[model samples]
Structure formats: C-alpha cells, structure tokens
Target: MSAQFIEKYRENAEIYTGSDICKQKSKELLLEINMPNGLLPMDDIEEVGYNRSTGFVWLTQKKPIQHRFTKIGKQVSYDTHVTAFVENRKMKKLHGVKAKEILIWITLNEICIDDPSSGKITFGTPTGISRIYPISAFEVEEDEKK
Candidate 1:
C-alpha cells in the first residue's frame, strides 16, 4: 500500500503493531501539519492541564492550525470542543482533591474512514482516551505553561 493509504488506514493497522509506532507516526503527522517548515518549536504547544487519575499529560496547540488529518481518497474528522471543555472544567475541579499533576485528555467522539479502493468503510468510537500528551510525561521537559 502507498504511504497515503498507510496513513489513512493507520488506526486500523494499529492493532497489529505496538503503540510506539502509532505514537511516532502520530507525532510525525502532527508535526507535518503544524510545522511545515520542519521547525517544531516547543512553544508552539501550550500546557492545558493534567489528569492525575490517569497520569496523562495534556497539551494543546498555542495556535489553531488545521486539526483535520487527510489523505487522497480518504477523509478524517474530529470534534474536540466538548471533550476539551469538559476536561478543562474537570481539571479545575481537581485542584482541591489532590495536587497530583494531571493532563487533560482530548477525546474523539467519532472517527470514520472511507476507503475508495476497497469500497470499505470503518468507524472508531472513542474509548475516552487521549490523543496527545505533554512532554512532561517522559520527564524530558515540563510543559512551560504548566
């Protein structure tokens, strides 16, 4: 399959591979979308919040570029408004519970893929998992804004 097709059907193929590959690919794709010049500055991302319950670090773009991921003969759409707001509010509520740092999660309510060649369709439902994380999780460098 072509790189385009691979990228288009990556989520489905993820089950066959480890999450490391998916993380690397996701980073590459997101970098391409936000950093066309190949310069991905750390400041381009902002620290939203953290989820102590899940121990995930959440980060959001300092600027809203194109959030959609696309490929020839394929389409991907995501809605972050509801999840983003809910997570942010929940983060605020956690301030008094435990000072444990947390990262907000962006949940994709729905993911639909249309394959023209095979004339097939695939849909993924959100398991309430996050798509991105703050660099802090790796202890590389803490999110500047956080």
Candidate 2:
C-alpha cells in the first residue's frame, strides 16, 4: 500500500512490524474475524496494520509469493502488499490477490462465509463470478508443539 494510504488509517490502527509479530498478528486477525488463519500463507512479513473502527487491514511482505493449496488443487498468488476491508466471516474490496483458473489468473475481490454452518466459503471476482469450496480447504492446522 502507498504511504499516503497507510497514513490515512494509521490513527487508531493496531500496527505491527517484523516478521514474527506481523505473522502472528495477521493470523490472530483472521481468527478474530472468523476466517481461516491459513488463508494467507505469506512469509517474511514486514508489516501488518488493522483499523478496527473501519475494518481495514493491510499486510506487507518482503516479496510476492505463489502458494498452491494442495488439498484444493488451486494456486494463489499474493502480492507484496495486500489490503482489504474485513468483517466477521467476510473480506471485501481485496487487492493484491489472484487465483489461477484453468488457464488464466483471476483477481479475487471478495470472500465470505454467509453461513458458518454451511461449512463452505465463497470467493468472488470483480466480474461477479464466484466459486464455493469447503472451508476446511483453507484451514491451517496448529502445530502441536505450539
């Protein structure tokens, strides 16, 4: 995200820097919002910021990354900077994230779980197209040692 954008929401935002803290904070934010912590598997995180009042969150990493969710046989690419407006079980206006379709990469703009009991999550694109997948596909198992 641009410095100007960050500055606009800096006030009253919970900001964390460094890889360890950023990673932990990001996961915690996801869990708090009723989303899968593993939805974002970026490493070398440089910063993370959350504005609770506006439900805005941003994360920055050392470099862009492409991760394949083996269980779902899908590949997702995350840019160095990602931003979104998140609320309980939903993330909207997402930026810097893309998913590989059969032969093309589609930008994902929204993700949500309308009903947790459905055990399904929906990913939508800017074109109004969407796909549903089992929520378990995005969950990350906690380390037993932790």
Candidate 3:
C-alpha cells in the first residue's frame, strides 16, 4: 500500500523498484552511478548490477537472462555492456538505501538440496554468495560519457 509496506511485504516487488514514488525519491542518486558498458553484470558484488526485466528488479547476480527461439535455435545474446541508462530523471532517484536486513549476514551458511524422492544433501553456501546493493551501482561512469 505504501513504500514501507511494499518494502516489507514485497522486498522484491516491481512496484518497490519501479514505482512512481520510488522514481521521485531516488532519481538524483540513482543517476550518478555507472551503467555497465553494454549490459549489467551478472555477478554478486558490493553493489548489485541488476536491471529490470519485467517486474521488481532483483539485485542479485543469481538472476537469469531471457531468451527466445530464433532461426539459430533458441539463441539469446547478453552483452552486459548495454545496460540501459535510466534517462527518466524521475526514476533515477530510487537508487540507494540499505535493503532491509533479511536473514542476518552470517559468514557462512549451509545450503540443503532435496530431490523430490531423495532425503537431502548439504553444501556450504559461501560468503559473498549474495549481496545487497548500494544506490550508486546504477550510475553512469564519468569516463563512459564521451
């Protein structure tokens, strides 16, 4: 219903990242960061190089690129250098802030994998596996402006 609520109920809601209110609030700050040369990076780092695909922008490298069928047999291209610049100054404002701490940051954690039939398997999910982004991650680089 509101920003705080949206940030709570829908941490990953499109409305949170792409809302009219969010646009107005984060525009100025968001526009200062560098967008990747072609597309946004798909890896975890301090600032998440995430871009909006359809709904709510997920700020994790864990996101997947979309693909479609073509003469080449379901081919897709992701340059990571062509990430779109947030031209709408209004939308640029919603860039930086500490995403609410979800599951406190632990140095390490165990990841469990369970097959529909099997019992379970445990693997170590390493640190830096995920990152919460700063607002500056979306800005355009100064050297990039030619």
Ranking by lDDT: 2, 3, 1
- Candidate 1's residue-wise lDDT over 1-146, tens digit each? 12242233234222212334433433443333221211112223432222333322223333433221222222222211111111211221111011111333232332222322443322222444332322222122224323
Which TM-score value belongs to model 3?
0.17
- By summed lDDT, the worst window of 10 consecutive residues in model 1 runs over 92-101
User: In candidate 1, how many Å is residue 144 off?
Assistant: 22
**Residue clash pairs of candidate 1:** 50-102, 50-103, 51-102, 51-103
> For each candidate, what TM-score against the reference?
0.23, 0.95, 0.17
lDDT of 3 by residue, 1-146 (tens): 12242243233334323333333323322434322221222222212223343222323222334333222222222221212223222122122111113434232222222331333222232433533222233223446333
* Predictions: Cα RMSD each: 18.2, 1.2, 17.1
* lDDT of each candidate versus the true structure: 0.25, 0.92, 0.28
Where's the lowest-lDDT run of ten residues in candidate 3? Answer: 90-99
Higher-ranked by TM-score: 1 or 3:
1
Pairwise TM-score winner, candidates 1 and 2: 2
- Misplaced by over 4 Å in model 3 are 1-6, 9-37, 45-56, 61-91, 96-146
Error of 2 at 123 (Å): 0.4
Model 1 segments more than 4 A misplaced? 1-43, 48-52, 55-57, 67-107, 110-146
Q: How many residue pairs clash in each candidate?
A: 4, 0, 22
Candidate number of the best TM-score: 2
